[model samples]
Target: GGGGGGGGGGNTSHCAALTHIQDCLNLAFSTLDPISDRQNAPPAHTGYRVHIHMQRSFASNERTASSSSSSPSSYFVPTLSYWCFIPGMAFRRLSAYRLRSIILTSGTLSPLSTFARELYVPFPIRLENPHVIQNDQVWVGVVPVGPNGRRLCSKYDMRSDANYQDDLGNLVIHFSKTVPDGLLVFFPSYAVMAEIIDRWKTNAGSMASFAALRPSFSNSGDSNSHLSSLSTWDRISRNKFPVVEPRESSEFPAAIEEFRNRLGEGSKGNQERRDEGSNGPSSSSNGAVFFAVCRGKVSEGLDFSDRAGRAVIVTGIPFAMAKDSKVLLKKEVLDQEARTQQAQIVNCSNSNKGNNNSMSNSNNMSNSNNTNNNNNKNYHAGNHTHVTSPQPNSTSSSSSSSSS
Candidate 1:
């Protein structure tokens, strides 16, 4: 939503969860693109489901929230209490009329007249606004790369160019020369993550980068990796990232819980053991930066509050669209539903005449955006050279996920 265009599609996890939501609606999702279960299948419904990402340009203090039955199913609920963070400020402007109903649910919504002008909505709809709550607050942090650093390939697939300089080593060199003290190393696949750890995992050999692998507990318990051998997490607790915010699935949840217990209320568990007493380098030889391949479900949604995750190497475009095709279908179904709804609204508006301006219909943009992401964006297939050094004022470095 920045500088005008946001083609970044939803991730595997994001899309997957949205599918489950579709299932709840009892809406049969068929063909979808980027990675479709079927081809050329027409959309079935006018009302559809859509998903998008929240970038700095379109960060919202407002969102669309729905109420469900007290019973729970196989879906990821916000805070397990139906309370979730819905930042939809951008959408409200795009179709102020369509978004009016959604934004009215929030009293303290950042007033639309000003935003409407920025977005150029067709019609204006004002209603009683609900108070925007901020109780479930979390801290967000950012850190800069050290002098002379670079992006690497192993960050994409450790199994591919593992040694950092194996193939795309030049990318790492192109970016920065100095790896940080608390280095977080990310590998693409689990096998790749293991490959790198087996090679550079040790305290004696001057353990520079701390390798972050897929923690069993961090998973959604619905993955095939759930049944695999997982002895890597034990290593992380000893000298790894010192255990930050852990999800409900990790095996060491008890250990993490105990540490967070010591921290009193909310914590990154407890870094007391990993922390330097008031006057150390305030850093760690833990490499200089943390490294991890975006493997399993190690990093997503969860908060990395307080500390700075300085260098975040996405080790490849998270996961592939083909990894799960059902979401693509569900995504398509949502699109169809939305299109059908738009048609319905248009038909109704024509039928009801101008007397019902509230029956206005909006075009389908959310679907088209995601379809693009599911295809071209995830894995760039071009002459992508390796890079490093966060390009001065640049925070989002293009993660090199080019296929050989």
Candidate 2:
């Protein structure tokens, strides 16, 4: 009897395909001996290393009621990645030796020597031109204290404090009221931004109470009555429409469009007020405040020129979390490399000292030999003069012989 059943042909083909894939993977991995070695290598030797990361996720498809009662469906995904710790290696590969030339230009490339050293390349010719804009064109100021006279510190420990959050919110409110057009506020991270926004909405005695005290207005004539009826968030939103940067890439376009539209509306309102000869608070312009994370989409490449970005307020420095596995690994690798470089420099200095000592000793020996040779020549000359002619006044004969 033939062994294959109805679906047996499909199973055979799938098995053959899997076997072929396995063979290919084996051949590829066999060539990567260094990567194989790195699997067991210590942190110090992890300059160029491969990391295996495990990701667990639930199945996207919903399980049947019968199956759900038994166990949830989930799977583990393993990802292997190779990382190069030395940034200089990349630059060296693309150096003048391999290519014609490498040119790097940036507005923020200050401390050029450090940058060049890190790249392991020498920039023989360098130019640093003066800024195109004059001093008065740009204005920079640091606000040390918040509206409540509390020190403005966005350190991780202080971020969760009630008083700190309230003061920070108050600072934002103050800026929102005063700064016309679009205000871009950047937080350290998405998580931090979310936490601050949550606090602003929920904290009864903080932002809500504060907003209640401030007078708000509507387009209608009864401004005081309208202010009393609005909620805390409504009061803040009325002053300026808030646009938050979404976490998903798919939603980014929509968020950006909303921000731009709000800006356009605010600009139109400002023009109308000016035409009517109305002298009112800047908040009356109905500008938009964009809340975005530092180093995110908004802060990275997007240009918010003119009225789109009147002021940019940075809440905190966007430093990487120290506890992250990748960060820790990178830090360890850099430290080890730094230590190795320092050791090489010290050894080189010691070797140089040894060479200098040897040279100095040889010079001293040569000088001594020259002195002895001169003495020997003098002795020989004296003996030759004595042998050639004998005289009763030896001193007079010696003087005459030397003079001759």
Candidate 3:
């Protein structure tokens, strides 16, 4: 997460590395007596071992690479070829211009490369190693696909969480079309990764919220088993953040409207459904969990077993990725201190025109937007009627939505 040279002087890295080692040793001593630690060593310690040998070995190499530079110039994502790289590929250039896009500098999408090499590839074709091999095949085969869907999108968007936020402020569909149940994760932004929570608050406390529902999907690579999170295909959804601030009493109409809309939907449908909770006497079997996430907070680090107990609705995209890499870099430092691998996704998501390439992604949604007379005129409807068919399972978005 630390930009460019990774938090300055070589001393910093060495100190951090030593501190990490010390902490690990201390934790080992404190958690288990030496006698028991040895017995459990194979699973707990050995299992978590990584051959940072390469990373260590590369220190001098990296230093040499950094100092050996023949030219005085700038380096960006494409040059490092980190975020722009596919899982596997033989890198051919190290200059910034050679990178994928002019925008990116770091993130989950960045490629791990040997700055020591002329090209970013390994010193030799050690692609036989499983991680290397897989990465190579992906780079050679899949990476070339628009330099790979992940790298391309990541390089460009900056903040591209797949979670789909809904019109309702508080409810967002993590994986569209798949309605969830009980205390939902209100990602707002992973609920899109920005915190549309404010949007939810505005909706929850505003004067005009009509049957609002928000939804989203998380791309932290979490599996459903851990917390019943949705997969791109398994068709479930995931994660959480925080809650919404309840509205002032003046928000009654909006709350009432939301209530009326719920009643209308529940009553107009199946028989016993009228009593399905929110409105009538019984709650619908199809329920949702509500999670509230605040921008610029520890939303991602904490895990809630009840992740999506109900269903999450989003307010708006949460916080735009920070302008510089400071916050993300600090997070990386903290995660490392605790011997954890937290995802640090950097994004440039403040663009006004969000990418709208997949409006039809969801199967459940029949309508995309609620057309008013002014808006509908463009669609030739002549009258201001609402279009209600939303795409089902449309969990991802480019996030061009306003809190409205």
Candidate 4:
């Protein structure tokens, strides 16, 4: 198969489909055996360019149990998507026909130039509207180091470590105090979130420390209360003391109601202060804190406006795990493709500047290296400071909307 990682998993149907696609492609290629070679072709510079990308790394699919399927290991279907674009094709087709207007809109197409290229929209015009929220209302901050001054990272290897979890819990507690009302915390994945929560619950001291910050609720969708899940009933369990739990039935609704009340109360207080010519920020006591995983139900189509979503705290960069086999395969393929394209560009650029002296070429190469290094640094810095939107169709910033 072209992108063969999906074969190992327990998905027999997907494996068969992949095999069929590969066979069909092989037959088609055999028929076109005398096709012209475009090995040295310019990268989308002239005419049309067909780009193929493997979709297995980040594609969404259900995990099949090995016991229920033919394959022993669970694997994802490694599919290939092709983008064939010809410059000016849109204009040529439009000129050949009668058309009034062709307006395109998309929420995901933030960086318009990339979308334009992929869609072959030659000479495209783009416009964007301002985000809904104002700058001063939202705040975006980057906490590179934790309260202990250690690097705040959540990579697969370090995320499960005791020290890392402690630091993460400490950071969450610290942020909870500063952020008012309902503060939504988004984790990279559900597995990571569950691990951290389980560790804290198992450790009484850690649970006490975390509880002191705020009443943290999770969008786990598990209807059973945390205490109910316990098989044993001790004296402490019957004490009617409130405990933070990751379930809907366990104080989640009550927390939300309390948060709403606090919002109303806070608004009245702020109004009174403003009426008295005091421009100080108001504080509230009845608000709640919520924890959710990225791409979870709460993070997607939920409305967390006003007091429901005063702040959003992202634990770490939500990149895919590097240790996964699919991720490794994707990295290798992308790195190889990038190296080939970069080499072609470098060769073409150098050939175009053949008249330049050796010293000039060396200087140009040095400048390129420096630029690449700087770009890498900037990317790493930006990735660490990444934060999700607290509400749908809303953007966050401390000073300006673009600051986020």
Candidate 5:
């Protein structure tokens, strides 16, 4: 991603796009060549194919989009992607044949047919289980209209707006106080999260008060002061930047140890203290507020059970970056494949119907051969009869989805 005619021109504008492409290339080349080190090499039994493709990425400028006087402008970023392809048989060994059974699941698996074909599962027994949790356990709300009556949205166009940040920050502060323990707030990307955090810390005074309510794990529950109260986070942020001299290597681990001590969730000391009925400042204080990025490590397979997590706040739907070269190519390939398959299915259906019709005609012609001399002409005409090919389904274009 890069600034699209918004930021100052030249190097700064290209930085984001360059960084993304560089990271992608690094990953590709890391495994591209066979190394002498056994640990670094691909499995000996696996067969692999490498693909290189050039993709044009256009940066989406959110600030420009929100401006009524100016239209959104995009800057083209050329990217080269290296892809590694392992055939379905490789996956089949581990998932299909190797495993006793396989279960594929997701919260939004609507239009299940697409998944069936993509996963190569010929006949899938799709099960959409009814909600086990009560309706009250789940809460859904739309973004409110702005003071000027413009409908609020977290789309690319609106996210950078000052009004949007204020609205979102207010909501966060509200939920932080009203909601119970262990609230998980997810942002679309780290850049967005960092920007919001910076704004809240600098501009929004309410956020400071809200931050004070939660206990910090930077120290060993000894500090109760507001800024100091956000101890673990404070130390992490300090370490990340150079406002002050960085601490020794032991500081991070020590800070983490202090954090675990407060959570009473991980180490033996905290667990033991919890069993002893001592309401340590960490345990007795208000619960944790975990800020995470969508699709990050926290959102993967980890279960936040019991008191660990009470509620989750998703600021917006996390859509894949459209301008990313690899992303665009993958979507294009899937859509093309879907259309091809649909056309093939239609052609096969037409062929089968035509064959049945010709068989019937041949039978009738044989019967009429004994009576009419023109029966041969009729048979030849029936043999020469053609059926127009079926057009590809119109809906296939929109039905394709990103590969899992």
Candidate 6:
């Protein structure tokens, strides 16, 4: 009986092992099938395209159980492997055909027509309501040139230029001095923010000199010339406490909390100054300036209303990298799809016009035949009447009839 029980346990273990192996085999086969067959598959109406990515990582751990004492071996390991069909496949799965309805709402859904086309879903009703805030509550402006009289361009090639970086820094400093309360400065990306901040730190002296200048000198005739000589760093620190967004997700909460604390302190200081009857501008009144990346944690899914964010300064347009694999692939797909749709529309229109022309030609031919038959009947009747009746002189009647 004990031997029988042991045999049963062994059989159960074998079955479990077989099941695990089967699952792994199924997963591997499924992944490979998609890669092999995706090309042969029909074009997805849901705007879905497969994206395959393989990430490699170097593993050099000396503490590994298999490592020898003499040498710490390093080897490249494939850390991640994934393939996905993206953009709207998931949403398409939950489309009106399957679900009762789909409603999309967002503040940033500009160019609604393009968005609807991409989703490949018919949005019969669309509303672009007025902003919730009154018109007077918001102010928008475009600054084409920097304080140093240089055109502000944040293109990839121009980003590394020392003069451009300095100009951008100076612009930020200028905003820090002018804008009250919390100032939100958004750079295109974290790399740009880091580069600009590094440049400012290196040229701290010129920034200090600029910050020391009185408000009256800011609007002087030589302000632009003076700005060309100056750089940026300590000006922001003197005017507004600087808070930077962190790259790591875990560090963001702390950064946000610090920003709030700084803003609160500035507000408190302003109240105290007002109580003392000093209405002049003070450093505390300048509040905190948050240096954040566009589309980062600070920019999206967060609110900084009222005193927390009195002004926002976007350094440049946050355009996607042209060389990015995903972006390039998506763009190519969209362009191809657009061309295909245009060709289809043209073909359909031409076919409809051809049918209409054929019908019109047939109808015109029938109408012309009817008109010719009526004219012939009238001519025959006139001749028959002339021959049958003779009341006046034949020549005179014939002449009158011809004249008539």
The digit string of per-residue lDDT tens for model 3 on 188-279 reads 33323223332232222221121121112323343334323222212222222222222223433333233223323323323455445443
Could you tell me how far off, in angstroms, the CA of residue 343 lies in candidate 2 after the best superposition? 2.6
Order the numbered candidates by lDDT, best leading. Answer: 2, 6, 4, 5, 1, 3
lDDT of 2 at 195: 70
Using lDDT as the yardstick, the better of models 2 and 5 is 2
| lDDT for position 31 in model 4 | 33
lDDT digits (tens) for residues 220-256 of candidate 1? 3423333222223223433333332221244335433
Model 6 misplaced regions, further than 4 Å:
1-42, 45-86, 208-231, 265-286, 346-404
Q: Give candidates' CA RMSD values in order.
A: 30.7, 9.6, 36.5, 26.6, 19.8, 11.5
- TM of each candidate vs. truth: 0.31, 0.64, 0.20, 0.43, 0.53, 0.60
Which digits, one per residue and each the tens of the lDDT, describe model 4 over residues 32-83?
A: 2211233543333232223444443321342211112221222455455422
Per-residue error for 271 in candidate 6, Å, reads 16
Error at 219, model 5, angstroms: 25
lDDT of candidate 6 over 72-142, digit per residue (tens):
23455443322233344445456535777788999999999988765556789999998789989999898
- For model 4, the stretches where C-alpha displacement exceeds 4 angstroms are 1-108, 120-123, 130-132, 144-151, 174-178, 207-285, 321-404
Model 3: what TM-score? 0.20
Best by TM-score: 2
- In candidate 5, list every pair of residues with a backbone clash: 218-231, 218-232
Candidate 5 wrongly placed segments (more than 4 Å): 1-79, 83-111, 124-126, 143-152, 204-263, 268-284, 322-327, 357-361, 370-404
